[model samples]
Target chain A: MTGQVRTVDGRVAGRRGQETRQKLLDCLREMLSTSPYRDVKVIDVARMAGTSPATFYQYFPDVEGAVLEIAEEMAKDSDTLKELVAGKSWAGKSGPTTSEELVDGFLAFWRKNDAILRVVTLGAAEGDKRFFKIRMTVLNSVAKPLAEAVKELQAKGQADKSLDPNAVSGALVSLLASAAEHQKAFTSWGVKVKDLKPNLAPLVYLGVTGKKAPK
Target chain B: MTGQVRTVDGRVAGRRGQETRQKLLDCLREMLSTSPYRDVKVIDVARMAGTSPATFYQYFPDVEGAVLEIAEEMAKDSDTLKELVAGKSWAGKSGPTTSEELVDGFLAFWRKNDAILRVVTLGAAEGDKRFFKIRMTVLNSVAKPLAEAVKELQAKGQADKSLDPNAVSGALVSLLASAAEHQKAFTSWGVKVKDLKPNLAPLVYLGVTGKKAPK
Candidate 1:
């Protein structure tokens, strides 16, 4: 479990202080969704939170610092992704259903936190170690479990044994991430938002089961 | 073919004018690689190019405009990605080879112009129409041809006819773009840089042909 939330000055936040901190984070999240990360200012976040900039500074050092806090929280929530692949069947009709549900759940999770995830992605891509670590945490939540499933299938002669399970799982998860991030791009390619899951689910099913999904 | 280079004011750029414009773009590209996109300034780019800010303004309206110019140029270069998939064999052993070469060649193209592409990715993800259009042009350079190949295979009964060729091709191309952009993520997964192509190629082969690669 995460330790008690602490201010930048190393003080443990009380119940009221935690509320104030949470409010600041909420406002920062909103700012991220409405404006480019570069334009998100501490003063704006403070104003939106109805708190002084000094109060904002007390909880977080800067916008990037606060963004990290938000990303870390999101990473914690990513634990739910584990259930999507864990204890799932990849045989016959169940395989396609598992894939469809996985695609649905993953895309929903991404859509829910896309604004912060976008910043985290950008930061990680820029070689920022902290952001990269956070991204890996989120990715591994699903990737590690999915890799296990691939390994299990490969061992049982249900999937391609020559392929590396980790690589396949990694590619599948990366594909999901890309699809979720650029859903609009898919629209431009003539794929409807509603049609996305059906299309992507089969690819996931194919990648994991190493066969065409059952009708 | 592209028409003659012109300044922002619609005047035809002479040899000297084109040199200044090119220098500014080079400097801008360098700046993007070294610093955060949010921090890249027109003044900094101009100074680095050994020109005045006024000279920078003559070529581009602002930093975003200059970034778009660089992105547009890179998209043109992306035409080369088409050759990687177009007219390529995907039969038996040749299928895996085609996948391998596509993976190798696409990753190289991304690595070569990563700085500009990074900005374009950010811009597109943020819903900037110009950036999104340019990103599509680059992706379509490969995705279009790749889709055609998939359609051919499906028609020949080599691929899954039930699946949408465009969807499969889009997903595969998205996987390639995501892999190229986050090479380090693969490294952290205990997959070595050299191991990436080998792992990715097979998946591409599987996705495209819906069959295991030949030995």
Candidate 2:
């Protein structure tokens, strides 16, 4: 992450600047906690964070920029998860066990960050410019390794040769994304992440392997 | 199509009524002519229509309502197209054939009333209670048949049976939606719909079928 810019007053680079920046983010997350992304406004964010309107402009260009920064950080976290999912193969009789690991890793992450992700998801589900666009980037990044994994599986004849593993790879990424979104939105309020896994894991498996497992 | 509600003199109804309603829609369209859904607003709409605030509300409840009424019509067009496509067999065929009919129908409608849709889309893309919730009704109405079409295609052994047709179906809907929003935002600058078809068709096909025809 880039360091907070300073005016060299040496008073922690000015109380206003440090407070405003963190305040904006604090407000952004708080607003997101209550509602979706499109509903939050720059003025509203400024007020919630206990900062002034002018101070908001000093820190970010517009609501989009402010939201973009927060979304970007969440995106980095999403990428780390995507990386974990994309690089491995699913375990069959003779192949590596990436699929099971992928499932367990994803569910665990989803359970852990369920709240923040619920807040950040407005970007994806709402089609916010800063929201959906970032996901498109993450998906493109995840696509390459996933394609490689699929190709390897196909070459080993561990997966269905008739299907395009590459396409399935991207589809798997989408499946997990939509599933997580669905879980957050529809899973009974206060439903724990542990409750999510039993349904989601099988659903994810079906997406990747095209098999109706014993769910 | 629902005919315009008329007054005692055979004009559009009370307050600023029919003529005013038409003007508001026309104004909203003009505002979107150069800008995008993401950049325009109710005040701009009222300004362009040359109407007062009270007059704007007489015809609809809010800004989104003004634009949403028209989008409801566009979504109806989508449904008619859905019926037409479902009447055919679209299994395993995720090439130029399936996408052309689907994309072309939306584009044709999109061409005739790009402005209203641009504004209506602003709500449809967001998840606002007053805005997006109504949009979702139209979305589900449109997506339902497409979902049925995929299920039918899978049952008929026309599409990829091994894949989850519902997941693929939802993916296709998201693809079209993503393209619509993208085209609305990007094309506001000057891109032609006809020029877009060739490339966009293939991309959405890939999104749906998750396969590319030997690029």
Task: Find the number of clashing residue pairs for candidate 1.
Answer: 0
Query: Which pairs, if any, clash in model 1?
Result: none
- Candidate 2 segments whose C-alpha is farther than 4 A from its true place: A7-20, A33-43, A90-133, A151-215, B1-17, B36-38, B50-58, B90-142, B146-172, B175-215
TM-score of chain B of each: 0.95, 0.63
lDDT of 2 by residue, A6-84 (tens): 4323234567677668778877777865664445787888888777877777777777677677767766776676666
lDDT of 2 by residue, B105-128 (tens): 655654565555444444433344
Model 2: share of true interface contacts reproduced = 0.00
Assess the local accuracy of residue B85 in candidate 1 as a C-alpha lDDT between 0 and 100: 93
Q: After superposition, how far is residue A21 of candidate 1 from its true place, in Å?
A: 2.8
What TM-score would you give candidate 1 relative to the actual structure? Answer: 0.94
RMSD of 1: 2.0
Span of 10 residues, lowest total lDDT, candidate 1 chain B:
B206-215
